[model samples]
Target: MKDQQDIVDNPPPGGSTGDPFTISNSLNAAQTVTVWIAKGTRWSDRDQVKAIKVVYADGTARVHGNQTGTSHSFKFDSDERVTSMGIWTGDRVDRIKWETNQNRTFDHGGWGGTEHSEELGNGILLGFSGSADSHELISLGASFREDSD
Candidate 1:
C-alpha cells in the first residue's frame, strides 16, 4: 500500500489532475480501494470531511461526491454526473463535445462558438488531456486508442 506522499513526486503512469479524489496506489483487476483518508483538508479553509470514493482503474471509472448526512447510517455515495466517464487521449479528441455548456448537436453550438452540445462525457467533455489551447491543430481523428475502437 502506498501513501499520499508516494504518489506525489512519482505519480503512476498516465495519471491526471481531473482526479478529484486522490489515489494511494495502483488498482488491480476486480480490486477495490477504500480511501480512509484518516484526516485531511477538503478546502484551503481546512474543512474536514469523511470524503470517500471507490477507485477502479480497469475498464471505466466511477466518481461521486459525498453530501455527508445523518440518519442514513452513513454509506458510500455515488455521483452520476461524472460516473463511468470515458477517458480521451490523443492529438485530436476522440470526440469534440461540449466545449462549453449549452445543449445542441455535433459540429454545432450557439451563435458565439459556445457549446451547448451533447453531454457525451463529463467535465469540459473536450478538456483535452493536455494542458493548452490548441484545438484548431487537432484533426478529425486521433490515431490514439482513445479514439480508435
Candidate 2:
C-alpha cells in the first residue's frame, strides 16, 4: 500500500460573484478519486452539475456528470487523474470533497468561482469551473464517501 497524505486544499473563492466558474487540482500519480458537489446546489430547473473531466495516465480524458442529483461521484483508475470539474445554472456548492490514492479524504468550503485551481506534487494541477446565466459561485460544506476496488 502507498502512504497517503494531504495533497492540497485549494480554498474556494470569496463567493459566487460571476458566471462560468472553474476549479482545478493536480496529482502525483494515478489515483482513485471521487468528486462531489454540495447538496441543494443542483436543481432541475436551475444551475445543475454539467460535467467532470478526468485525464487518464495515457493523456486521454473523459467527461461525466449528473443533470439531476444533489451530488455526483466517480472513480479514476489508479493511473488516472481528475483534471477539472464544474456545474451550471447554479452557483455555490455547500461542500466539496475528494479522496486520492485511497488515503485520507480532503475537503474545503467557500468553493465558488468561475475558475479555481491548486498545484499538486509531480507537476499536477486540479480544479473546477463552469459557466451559466443564473449562477454565482458559493461555498459548500457537506461530504460523502465513495469506495472502489
lDDT (C-alpha, whole model) for all candidates:
0.22, 0.35
- Highest lDDT model number: 2
For candidate 1, the lDDT comes to 0.22
Local accuracy of candidate 2 as per-residue lDDT tens digits, 1-149: 32224334334433445354333323333223233333334443333233334443555453334333333445455444333322212244433444445353444323333433433343233333333233323432111111211
How many steric overlaps does candidate 2 have? 36
Q: Model 2 off-target regions past 4 Å?
A: 1-6, 14-45, 48-71, 83-91, 94-113, 123-149
Q: Give the TM-score of candidate 2.
A: 0.31
> Each candidate: how many clashes?
3, 36
After aligning candidate 1 to the native by TM-score, how far in Å is the CA of 25 from where it should be?
Answer: 26
- Candidate 2: give its CA RMSD in angstroms: 12.5
Which candidate leads the pack in TM-score? Answer: 2
Model 2 lDDT, residue 43, Cα = 40
**What are the RMSD figures for all models against the true structure?**
15.4, 12.5
lDDT of 2 at 96: 43
